[model samples]
Target: MTTVLWFRRDLRLHDHPALTAALETGPVAPLFVIDPPLVHGRWASPNRTAFLLATLHELDAALRERGARLHIRLGNPTREVPQFAREAGAQRVIVTRDYTPYSRRRDAAVARALEALGIAFHTRRGLLVHEPEEIRNATGKPIAVFTPFYRVWQTLPLRPLHPSPAHIPGAPGLDPGEIPTPASLGLPRPVDALPAAGETAARARLQRFLAGPVCTYAETRDRLDLPGTSRISQDLHLGLLSPVEVVTRARTLGCDTAKFVAEVAWRDFYHHILWHHPRVLHEPFQAAFRSLPWRNAPAHFTAWATGQTGYPLVDAAMRELAATGYLHNRARMVVASFLAKDLLLDWRLGETHFMRHLVDGDVANNDGGWQWAASVGTDAQPYFRIFNPVIQSKKFDPEGAYIRRWVPELRRVPESYLHEPWTMPPSAQEAAHCVIGHDYPPPIVDHTLARQQAITTYERARRASASEPPTQADR
Candidate 1:
């Protein structure tokens, strides 16, 4: 009557549905498998890898506190999970479900392998407030858009929280493999320092945000210069903090928690979108724009990626992401809009770049966000409704604090010309001890010209999607 509990994103013990359910059956052998392809394959991420390794250590220590320890395996989960389960004499393998396209495929393979060995494979709902199948359209498919989904999501009752087990009986006589360091994996330690990882740290951060930040989140969330946001996206990504725990706790505080809860609903919405339409992974959800022409200019892309674009806000967000493996949600929208609309690069390129760099990159959320900015997803911005970079900078980062912190070359530039340093006269530039094209690079592309051209190109694609043949990218 033993079970192998495989931890994926839901790394925590408190409020864990799968862990609680598994422990009810019998003693549990907690397991974590590090797949090679995730660490070294096409979509590898150094920042996330470093963070995961650190979190695994914390999870292991937490298990030891409860008379259990984490078991590690380094290989394909399809092979490793079942192998470890059988070796531990477990009759079943249990996990909290993940909904990405790749995760679904991996889970299916693992289940098939486990079934062949007469081991029951069970998936529990703990990561999201509602699974894809739980909220559906009239057609019985997951809701395609968020508004209708949210309308239904709020009315549903939430399952009560599960208390952590006082004692966990670990499977006897199994070798818990050693956790590997970044160097041992042939990857460099991340330059951006990661947060104190694990459930305890996750809960502490949540408490800090709840103390005061959650009350004014609706008012100050958009100001990019201020630290007004919860900054818990990374913890949510790794499942150190359960969505249910975060949402339920915030509501209990008696603040106007609607907006914050709505944001959580948005996260659940994207997961449901990915669950229903896996094709969104390789193509746009709004199929009409899949064939949309992208300039994909190498020079423009290089400038945008390295934070050398003449626009200060765009540059600051990209640079901040490089330095800290994190960015404010407001900043995320600005840079994403700049990339897809202004630069007219392929949105997928930006998505892949972020996944490779961000510590909190989740497939459903990141893809949905990139596609939204690109104007090619459900509830997306209209392609013609472009973000004027200068206007956005002045509105969201009015004081230029964010730009100054990330782009020090503009620190000496006066407040008047900080957002548009190229506009400063040569004499004024000298007074500030900064020179455009000398100290800081000039704007790579003219926004006015780019804006006009982008609108025309998108209009042309809109027509093509209705009548003319699609472009090669669509094929």
Candidate 2:
């Protein structure tokens, strides 16, 4: 009997555990389900959808080159996988496990469905270095803070990386439909250049980053003007590149490259947190933060969404996201912090917006970043630590080259006034060829007032928490 390989976010053929498992079986049927939840979710964006479709097309092509093809299915995995297995006469299903609550539940339902049909189910663990329950504190509970969680994560042993299988045991009888496009999914067309997909492109990207930028990554990653960071986040999120391969490669480079390796660890760190504390998805990770009075303003959210925030740096980041389906990490932080702290909006709003735009967006990273900015998640930055958009622009993008690249109106402004066009003299503003209120919106909210309000609001929430102590303190 053939084994079924169920592909989700792990799209690539190389360094894939489930794919390896399927090959080890007699014959394999590779499958991907385009579920309604994924299609209609808030995180779904035309840009992301287009990139995903393109990637599937690439993966399908790669499989064809190897005398196999990805079997694309459209329906709930629980309903689809079992049906596909029964139709194809498969005895077992193989898949890379996902830590997100939605994925976990979906997989469980599929597993149960398969078991009832007398089909075996197997899941692989290496999507993350440390599986959620694998790393625990001395007390056997998941760590709630990142620093301690990271420290604990460092000590956990990881599996060795696997090479891509040369031959995928083909389930020759099964045929699949055409891979869906953004239009087929009823999504708008994306207007950005997505990186080429498949194991080949992923490996080449890793090799190129190692040859040059890996050394300076620690220093230049924060500089928005430089192409310092490895632009592999989308690849990793899509599973075109495995975390183990990335970590192993970074270690092979040594010295400063270790920092790049640590960033991979950071990705795992967030995934483990989400797996252990799934509540972080719907509520604050830190209990005291549950009471935050987040402003629920849809119009303000629309402005932030369309990049018309009246703050150049924030607006520029938002515009970049709208145009490119990507934003620099520093820009992500600035825009996220501006939305949550300065704009006093809910972190979920920002999280959804990011998911909609970022080609690199992952459930763990997007949620972790938003919660950190909002000071509501494990190891989150304090809420009082608000970022002033103007100062942040000057500090990170000093030449305003980054701003000028995305925001053409600010191109003629002197570097000194690029971050603060409103500060320019009336004549200087005219000479720069733009009007603050006419060409661009004014600052939506005064930074100073917002900062103080955010601080006070957080402080009050923390202070107002229930003081009742647990009756059974320590077992």
Candidate 3:
């Protein structure tokens, strides 16, 4: 009997449950399907596509080293996977499960098709450390809030690490298809800088982070100017490194690993939320805030998108995202807060924009983060408690190092006025060779006024919602 090892988000060979399961059955036909929706849909990103292509090439190379090769196919998985399995004469197909709404639906369709062909379809939990259903509240319902969910998540037992196969035997006379380039998928070749892809690069990064930076991650993670983050988000998103391996290795480092571990748990938390409440993708989690008024100003959004918002930290973060497809955690919060609160724009706009730019943008985490910033999701920041861009800049990028690096117009500006360039006098601005409206745009909206307006908007929405009769339209 032969089996097909279907690769999805879980790309690496190490610690792969589905691959091991397939190997146990018989010689495996390793398969990767390039679904059209992922390449041409709204969430399609050029940078991400480039990274995925490079990662696939690396994965194929690794498979060849083990006397096996990855089979590539293009088109819908619902049709392609079953067809390929029949052609390969495989009796079973083993795959890692994905939790997204689209993924779940597609998997069901593929399963039905495979069953009709007499192929046993098996899915293993590999994307996350724990499945969503495994962790719940005392009432047997999914946990809505993060802290309690995290506390429960810490108590669960992790699955033992699955060893990588030294040799993977393949079925005879099977032709391995070539991995396609980004342009073939109708995506532009990425112009922005991106990290090296594949399992080896991911392991190296994880090892380096655990060796030192993770010890001080809690305190220094908020400092945007420092190289404080693990920078392994892309690896985790691409499945270059498994969450199980990451958590297991970090556990050996002692108490310093707690904060970093919590971050990993946060990834699980968002996925858990998405698994239980897929509606959050299209609407606010908190029903009362569903009809909250948003200005949806296109001009303000343009300013924010192009890094001309005149807020140093916000501009710097936006520019960094455009140039490198990555942003610091603190910077992400600041820019997200600015868009939702200060600009009174719909959080979905910012969410969609981030998805299009960030190489590490996963549906669950990105949507959860945007909703949290907008104060519309479980355990989100209070609507009245908005981030002050200037204050955040002073606290995180105090020396203007991060700001200057990304926003070059502010390079000559004095450190004192860097965060609030508009506060600089005419003579000071002239001396610095940068004028507020000429070289750098002025602040798009006054934070103080925007904060008050946002508070009033939410308060008014709550009162109106309280008086209105319940309607089916409410989420």
* Structural similarity to truth (TM-score) of each candidate: 0.97, 0.95, 0.98
Name the weakest run of 10 consecutive residues (lDDT summed) in model 1.
466-475
In the range 1-475, model 2's lDDT, one tens digit per residue, is 6988888889887778788778775888888899888878857877767777888888888887776788999988889999999977999998998999999899999999999999999998657766777767889987777678778876766677787766665778787877888888888777757667666787798889999899888899999888998888888888888887787777777566867877887898888888877878888887787768989888888888887877888888988888888888888889888888887899998898788877888998889988988888888888789888998998888898888988888889888788878888889889988788887677788899989998998888888765634234111
Per-model lDDT: 0.88, 0.83, 0.92
TM-score for candidate 2, residues paired by index: 0.95
How do the candidates rank by lDDT, highest first?
A: 3, 1, 2
Candidate 2 Cα misplacement greater than 4 A, ranges: 466-475
Task: Compose the digit string of candidate 3's lDDT tens values, residues 18-79.
Answer: 99899987788999999989988978888888998899999999998998889999989999
**Candidate 3 Cα outliers beyond 4 Å, as residue runs:** 472-475
Judging by TM-score, tell me the better candidate of 1 and 3.
Answer: 3
Candidate that beats the other on lDDT, 1 or 3, i.e. the better one: 3
Screening candidate 2 with a backbone cut-off below 3 angstroms (N, C-alpha, C), the clashing residue pairs are: none
Clashes of 3: 0
C-alpha positional error of residue 29 in candidate 3 after TM-score superposition, expressed in Å: 0.8
